[model samples]
Target chain A: MTPGRKLLGHIALLVPPFGWLGIFYLGSLSVLLLSAFWQVDAMSGEIVRDWTWENFRILFSDTTYTVIARRTTGIALLVTVTDIILAWPLAWVIARKVGPRLKLTLLVLVALPLWSSMLARIYAWRLILGHDGVLNWGLRLVGLPDQNVAFTNIALWIVFSYLWLPFMLMPMVAALERIPASLLDAAGDQGATPWQVFRTVVFPLAIPGMAAGSVFTFAVTQGDYVAPMLVGGAGSEFIGNVVYSNVGVSGNVPFAAAFSLVLLAMVAAYMLLARRFGAFDAQ
Target chain B: MGPNVLMWNTKDITTAPTSWSIIYDKAYAGVITVPDNPIQIADAALYLSHTKPELGITDPYELTQPQMDAVVTLLKEQRALVKKYWALASDEVDLFKSGDAHVGAAWPYQANTLRAAGVPVQDIIPSEGATGWADSWMISTHAQHPNCAYLWINHVMTPKVQAQQALSFGETPANTKACAEMDALQPGSCKQYHADASPAYFSSIKFWKTPVRQCGNGQNTCLDYSAWQRAWQQVKQ
Candidate 1:
């Protein structure tokens, strides 16, 4: 083939993906940003062709929204930390300690929950966490007091950790696997304790993986409305729930867009910070 | 939609609560659940209309900024007592059945479902009255088959079909004639669903409608649905 013809064919292959990124990804993002600055007609609840900072002003000035932002951020941070801690040991066992067959089985078990619909899994948690749920039933069977945590922030915390644990685990396993076994043996030869070796050698190296996994765990929790709506109650309203009510019930697209931008900015800031910490080094 | 019933566990308390104030009581903290909808704001307003007459909220859906502020304050207090805000009727049903929610604002359907599951609960229309919706069939403005749309509307409006819908969906039929047909389908179903309700009974319920700037009081200054929605988010927050 001629050099020019070959080069043209290469560019042709790049078009579809670039088109998707540009049109679907960046394009929608641009629309969202622009709509945030648009105005809403109070009477008919229509988006007017006018530019205003009213939506953002309400978002910032409102104390209730400030509380919401804190709640969403607080939960997201809690979930990220919980997932990292939970995933660390399991990732270690599967990556280093297990036989090949067992590793495969363990990995499958970690991913099995993801195959089921998230909605179904969350609902199952209700069956387990509700007042007369499995947990309470088991407690009663053991002659323990019945506990109620079904529709509170505690439920949100438990469900979020369960849902995002796998996301944390995969990256964690990848990071742990990348660690050379020689380092551990060398540490032992130098008379370093196992705790010392893990703390110094294993933990620092796993940072990148934990960081990578946290981007998913943290960001998804920050933007999640479904779990909160389904499992969350009075004090458990998230930023996404407000955004949804604005768009779905009120038909206030501009306001919803504005609130979404706040979420985007928060998640974007976290990702950028994670990137700065070299979370993507493994990738 | 049926009236937003105030339901409580029969075993938890022997006496049925008469006021909406019980949902806001601190005694029920972390066990109260209500619908997680923008329309829930109206319920809060309806509660205030009786208690705080100075706010002058004649229609639960219609409110001035000051009235909204009062309602918001009341709801924010109630927020702390809530265990969760449920979206689906089944969620509320499960909550009550599981004994997670001892007292909550729910619909008749949940009360029925819970009772069917052998959970002892009683639902009452609080002294402040209640809010509800009368779902209707509407033809799309831009329907490609306008003739078919009108035919469908007419078909559903007929007494026999209306009775069928009333029985199946558990909503009162608009056609008064359908009430008799409903009884024919299932004896006492008409009275059970309140399809043959007295005018006074009908007036007690504040059926839901999209709040507009131009309200029933003929004032252009009333806060619209968007405002209620925006305020609802803050109240929940």
Candidate 2:
């Protein structure tokens, strides 16, 4: 085909996806951002389309929003870090030490939880973590004191970590598998210790993968409100919870939109930082 | 419609809690729950309206600035005692069934579900009163089958159907004549839910409504629904 025809073919290929993104994703996002500047009529509970910054002003001035935003970010960071620590060893074992057949099994095992309903899994956690729940029952059998971690930040942490662990594991496993066995063999032959080989070779190469995983773990935890609603205790309000309540319960769409923009800004800033740290470098 | 009632584990409490104040008691700290909504602020106001008469809180939904401030302060104090604020009836049921919460605010559905699941639980409208919802069926103007909608409404409004719904859902029927029908359907179920009990019983319940700044007493100084939402968020935090 001629170069002009090839260019036309390429444009045709891009049209469907670009059109979709433009109409749905970008279009809806723009509408959301625009609504954030509108105000809600307090009496009638109607969205007044006039431009105003009252929603943003309230968010900035009220210390409650700040505290909620901080708490949410803190939980997201903690979940991401916990997933990394938990997934690294498992991913490494599957990618390196395990046989191909077992590696596939291990990968499936990591992903098994995702197949079930999220609400069902969170409810299962509720049963496991409750005061007289399975965890406490096991503790009694083992002669250990019950932790009583249900409905606390600790419970939220456990659920969030569990929910996002697979996202972290998959990328790390892929990165680890890409490392040639000859490189490790050479490192071992050059008098490098096991710890040194890991620290110098495996760890550096896995940074990009870890960063990629962190993006998912961080973003998902940051925006999730359902887990918090079902499992979170008092004072465990996330930014998502605040935004959801505003929209669903309060019927204050403008404020909800504004609150969402705040969350979007936070996620965007985190993505920029992650990108700066070479998260997308492999791509 | 069912109201929010105080529910406690029957096995844990020898004497059922008789007042809403039991929720605020320090003894139940870390084992009590309430609804995770701004509407719950009215419950706090309802308690204060009876206990702290000086606040002059006649209507829970139409609270002036001072009354609202008092309610907010009371809720912040109650916050420490709350184990979790449940958003769903199922959440409350699971909490009670799993013994995560010993006592808290709940709906009749939660109590009924827990009882059916073999969890020993009881619910009551406390001495200070309770908050509840009243639902009505409305047909849209643009509805394709307006006649059918009206027929359905008329059918449900009949004493027999009303009693059936009231007994099944554990709520008082709007049709007072349904009391006899409810008794026939299920012995003592009408009295059990206080159906056709007394005018005072109905008056005691502060029906749930959106809080607006315009007070019933013609005062515009009351806090609106957004304020309640913000205050509830602050209280939870």
Every candidate's DockQ is 0.80, 0.86
Q: Which stretches of candidate 1 lie above 4 Å from their native place?
A: B214-220
Give chain B TM-scores in order. Answer: 0.91, 0.93
lDDT score for candidate 1 against the true structure? 0.87
Weakest lDDT window of 10 consecutive positions for candidate 1 chain A: A40-49
Worst lDDT run of 10 residues, candidate 2 chain A, spans A274-283
How does candidate 2 score on lDDT? 0.89
Task: State each candidate's clash count.
Answer: 2, 0
Candidate maximizing lDDT = 2
Superposed by TM-score, candidate 1 places the C-alpha of residue B11 at a distance from the truth, in angstroms, of: 3.5
How would the docking of model 2 be graded? high
- What is candidate 1's DockQ? 0.80
lDDT for each residue of candidate 2 in A10-92, tens digit (9 for 90 to 100): 99999999999999999999999999999888777888999999999999998988989999999999999999999988998
Backbone clashes counted, model 1 = 2
lDDT of 1 by residue, A1-283 (tens): 9999999999999999999999999999999999999977877556897889999999999888999899999999999999999998899999999999999999999999999999999999999988878999899999999887777788999999999999999999999999899999999999999999999999998989999999999999999999998888777878998888788767888888999999999999999999876688785
Winner by TM-score: 2
Docking class of 1: medium
